[model samples]
Target: MSNTKDIPFSPPWQISDLGKPDEPKVTELAAGPAVARFAKMPIVIAEDDLVSRTLMNSLMEKWGFKAVVTKDGHEAMAALRAEQGPALTILDWMMPEMDGLQVCRRIRESGKMVYVIMLTSLGAKENIVEGLHAGADDYLIKPFDKNELLARIQVGLRILELHAALSARVKELEKAVGQIDDLKLRIPL
Candidate 1:
């Protein structure tokens, strides 16, 4: 992990070095367009109520994200572990299998940096504090206007972007430190 060189540009077996010398550079041509045409990343939306889930899904899709709708917190957790998971989750506070608070706790315990927004009917100060304590990045009370919901989500996305940038910077610093160590090792005593 200290070495960025160990991180491959493409995984083994993804491309072959055994190709003909004059193969027209097919791999680069194919990959260039594929990466350019990448689809919108998905967002997972968990709401037990049918109407609420549908509304959330429609809103998320309208915002140019692929939305996965689930009626239970447990199901949403499973989706989170799936390959190519959503970068963010919008959770309703009340749900079967497990409640939103429990789900948020589980997500935090897993130590993955997935953005979470808890949409609940409970608007009291204590309730908001509890949600924040349970690891919700944003808390939205029920009967919230669509504009507010979008605005909060926009804020969450910005926060997530910031987190990603910070992570990258940390990785870069670690790599630089490793290089310095390597250079020191090569120096005479």
Candidate 2:
């Protein structure tokens, strides 16, 4: 398979169209009050341990995200494919049916703009490298700091915003190029 991209833009239907923005819901936070609301990104957290799952799910909500708690990789994949499934995903390394590494690889192969974050107990350098090579956008040790997790999530959100911007630009460029081609064809040359 060639690495070259003729038109690497996302499918028209899949493009993140920011048109007709959703009505903003005003919510008060402990830190402050009143601000414009943006679309809450769907965060898929695949964790088998009940305690951990509940903790992470609540944390994600506290950090302003819609969390889909899945007990296995299959469930995680299903959530990722859903219409409401946004690009950010958090996968626990150990899960039944399939492991996080496998899920990450599959997500990468599918090329759906999904960001896979592997949260595992393994802290070895080799393990970290392996997870990243297997398509994990980020990897966190099991006993992660809540603040750190939120920081990482913010970084991912910024990257996703950039992706949507680029995708929109691609569509605009395609239209402009098409118009130029049509004009060229109209002229006698």
lDDT of candidates 1 onward, in order: 0.70, 0.73
- Deviation from native of the Cα of residue 65 in model 1, angstroms: 1.5
What tens digits encode model 1's per-residue C-alpha lDDT throughout 83-155?
3422578888878779999999999999877889999998999999999999999999998987777666656
* TM-score top scorer: 2
Per lDDT, the best of the predicted structures is: 2
Per-model TM-score, in order, reads: 0.76, 0.79
User: What number of clashing residue pairs does each candidate have, in the order they appear?
Assistant: 0, 0
Distance from true location, Cα of 88 in model 1, Å: 1.0
Q: Which ten residues in a row have the lowest lDDT in candidate 2?
A: 30-39
